[model samples]
Target chain A: MNRLLAATLLSLVSSPVLACDAVQLGTIEVEQAWSRASIGTSRPGVVYLTIRNAGTEDDALVSIDTPISGMPMLHETVVTDGIASMPHAMEVPVPADATVALEPGGYHGMLMDLTQVLKEGESFPVTLTFRNAGEVTVPVSVQGVGATDAGCSENNG
Target chain B: MRLTRLQKALWVAAGLAIVAFGVLVTIMNRAPEPAAQASFRPTFSLPDAEGRLRTAAEFEGKHLLVFFGFTNCPDVCPTTLSEVGQVMDDLGDEAEEVQPLFISIDPERDRELGLAEYTNAFHPAILGLAGDQAQTRAAADSFHIYYEREDTADASGEYSMSHSPALYLVGPEGDWLRQFTYGTPASDIVSDLQSRL
Candidate 1:
């Protein structure tokens, strides 16, 4: 009975880990990384995630690399006077003890010139380089074409 | 000077006619103006994916759902187009009455990048439109859509085109119907279109 119970518990513990969850590195915790399924491979893809800094010192996301795209850069979408413009962001600042969210219509990681099509229900790895925390690779769940959030539960299937 | 019965009856009829006329005028004045009267009716004459020239007049009997964006857009454009695809799906059989047009603000690059393939990835009902610089500017001006190319280019010698993100709805008679702001849910748009249809 003890052996059977252990097996069941092990499966339960491993299940959630398989899903796109959180990854911790040093004082930074990255979670809820996700991207929408790309419509075309020629068009650029985007990644949105949240970074939480627990340390006293501030950190900034210096660079991002993903195998899906050759060129990954930080971009901010700004809307002014009804015109939407996306300017390249050199880095995203993560203040100490604060959470910075890279979401839709705001800050996002632009995956330029995607090497492959991002299909729904698939997850990919993106390595984010932070000035203080170094490099932390997190799995990004691919949601529906129009999904606004990571929705890890829904994408787990 | 009292009038005879026939004269008195005619005077009463005239008085009632004047009151009815006054009420009619008041109702007319209070009625809401047509949407086209309140706003400009946008028009576009551009080339489709097949390089066929298409004009606003061709879709006079159907509702036009227009969005201006470029193929190279990373986030907002794709998200909005996906929502539009969902809206078209939710519309079901009623979808035939609707025509969705994705006008490329960056016509040169969009044409080279295959505008049709990009839009078809979202929904087949969406017709990708592109034109020369002058033609594109004219169409954008008619819709009051502002778009400008950034002066800087990335390492790949590629630049970004900034443009308006609002989705416009035009009636069958080419009247300005409504504008759906960015991030509006597909369900909400479906309900709105159903009511209007």
Candidate 2:
């Protein structure tokens, strides 16, 4: 019983810290990963994050994997002539020493076939694979429904 | 040439007739064109989330905020709805006089997915409307909204919908008032609505 209590306390104390910290692999830093609370299980969800490449070499986000979703894909919402179309992005190129922000009304990570409803204040782990930087898992916090931004300071890292 | 009294009276009548015809033509050209007005002033009859038949007449005396989108849309639709919610909140008590309707372009899937639940997550005041394919098409036609399903579908047979992203504002008299284009800030929309309301 004492061991179980200690494990529970440790999980509660470590979860938030893990979600708040930015993950760095090589020179690629992934931060401010967040998603809005889902309305229903049938519809898809989305994840927004910022990827900054500090190295002189350019990289690209090739793929994404998350246990919360069955099919995770990178999609871009293109608005042309007042029409909006969401197309599957083959890959998002991150230039050298530049930041690529996956935001609303632009590029975003589409979470298809959600296993469970994303509740507010919860966090999920998503493994983002880069062409050059390899793979790095980042914790994505679930914000309120219709949240525009992560609503947190970048200094949390 | 000297004219007789009868000829002089006939000449005066002809001049008066020409003047009257010129005045009539100018008035006709200056009058509002019904065809142009009718094109802009569109109406619709569809079923709401509660399955009740709702028409434009039902929203008489209140401004109608209409947007066309689908619940399956993960990005632009929700972002626009959130901005609409912000506008409503900024309106404060004046929001009561505004009715925001989210018309689903993908009605079949939206109905099964629970449209009300999806919209209420952004704003409870936003009413989600869906209809059969024919009815949905008719409503979209009236509003000049365009929507097309992509040929590509996921392994689960789910597809995405491409649609117009403009938010239309209808006056209390059921006339097209203004259009808030995609990405317009909520503050601008609130100020416009407040001035009109």
TM-score of each: 0.80, 0.85
Q: Can you write out model 2's per-residue Cα lDDT over B119-184, one digit (the tens) per residue?
A: 898899999999998988998888877899985665666689999998999899988886798989
- DockQ each: 0.51, 0.68
lDDT of 1 by residue, B85-194 (tens): 99999999999999999999999889988988888878999999999999999999888778998855645677888888989999999988888888788898899999
lDDT of 1 at A103: 88
Per-residue CA lDDT of model 2 for A12-111, tens digit only, reads 3345445556789999998888888897677789999989899999999999999999989999999887789999999999999999999988999999
Whose TM-score is greatest here?
2
Q: How much lDDT does candidate 2 score?
A: 0.88
Model 1 residue A31 CA deviation in Å: 1.7
Q: Once superposed on the true structure, which residue ranges of model 1 sit more than 4 Å away at CA?
A: A1-19, A154-157, B1-37, B153-155
